[model samples]
Target: MSGGLAHRWDLSAAAAIALQKSLAGQVERADRLGPGGRRAIRHVAGVDVAFEEGGAITRAAVVVLRRADLVTVESAVARRPTRFPYVPGLLSFCEVPAILAALTALSQRPDLLLCDGQGLAHPRRFGLACHLGLLADLPAIGVAKSRLIGAHAEPGPAKGDWAPLMAPGKTGGRMMRIGAVLRSRAGVKPLYISIGHRVSLRTALAFTLRGTTRYRLPEAIRRADKLSKGGAPG
Candidate 1:
């Protein structure tokens, strides 16, 4: 773990909330991805978690794909005894250890990560993607199936249309931008996109759209989800 974000995972609910608040400030909400100049994003990773043994075990799967063609280049899955109880806002505590293990098993690190959870859109402004990105020091984005916080108008019916998701700021009477509600596919429900670390919201949206084809979620995330649910890894 990075020095600033280093902390224990096993903690009381109050401690977890406090830890989130402390680490949330470390998440960089800026664009720092790709191979610097003229190099396109080549490898992108998707991470998801599933439960087994009636939720006693946490299964984390990571799928790295070729960015241009969305072909699986590498994949890994890790199983660990669930360490924390299901907490609404403290999801990273329950899932990130196994996720880190799975990521460590990969042959090479991906250029970007798409996490199946929230990011800066959470109550503490630090969700699973933010936590994982800080721990791994990788550019990451959150591609959530549903909203965890914030409110927004319905996105347009067409694919690629999006609307800003806003929430009340710490100070009263101020609305802060948290994430975006995106229509990944025309006929399907919109997705919630947010910056996890080292990437801007616009860049996150672009990469997410580039990774989506014929589905409401990105192909990397879809594959990772399947693997996390016990599907064979490629």
Candidate 2:
């Protein structure tokens, strides 16, 4: 990780919030995955963390899959003590240390990262995905099963339907479009899609739908989730 991205993880809730606010400005929402405006996503990695022993230990997993065939390319896990408390918006601080370890263990870094948490759809606009993307300096997207912040209408029951996620502007200003509510599978709850870093929301959604096959979650993320839960890597 770069020195600017790798900062103090041990912080109080107030300090963490301040850090988030400061770093949020560095998050780039533009598409940076291609050479010349073309799709260049080849490998996508999913990241997740699980707590064990009464939330005292964290098991972080990262699974990389080939975008064309969805074949597992690399997988890694890191276990460490839970350093930070479970604050609502500061989840990255609690989980990212181990996640970085797992990423470092990989022989090949992925082109994109898919996090099982919020990105721009956050109160301070710096969620776990955003933090990881910035730290890793890779194009990343957040595919959360639920919302962390923002409001949106329910999408259609069919797969691929989506609605815009809106939040009240800063300081009670106008409404702001943050992310999207996307139905990844037919007749299932929608997933929250948001820009992490170095990717546009549209490209993030495209990559997400392409990565998803028979399940609501993307294939890479499914594998990572399983690994985090002590299941064998895919």
TM-score list, all predictions? 0.95, 0.95
* Candidate 1's TM-score: 0.95
Tens digits of per-residue lDDT for model 1 on 32-134? Answer: 7875422467899999999999999999999999998899999999999999998889899999999999998988888889999999999989999999999
Candidate 1 lDDT at 213 equals: 93
User: How far is 149's C-alpha from truth in model 1 (Å)?
Assistant: 0.9
Off by over 4 Å in 2: 1-4, 34-39
Residue 118, model 2: Cα distance from true site in angstroms: 0.4
Candidate 2 per-residue C-alpha lDDT over 92-200 given as tens digits, one digit per residue, 9 for 90 to 100: 9999999999999998778889999999999999999899999988888989999889989999887788999999987787999999999998977899999998888
lDDT of each: 0.91, 0.89
Per-residue error for 96 in candidate 2, Å, reads 0.6
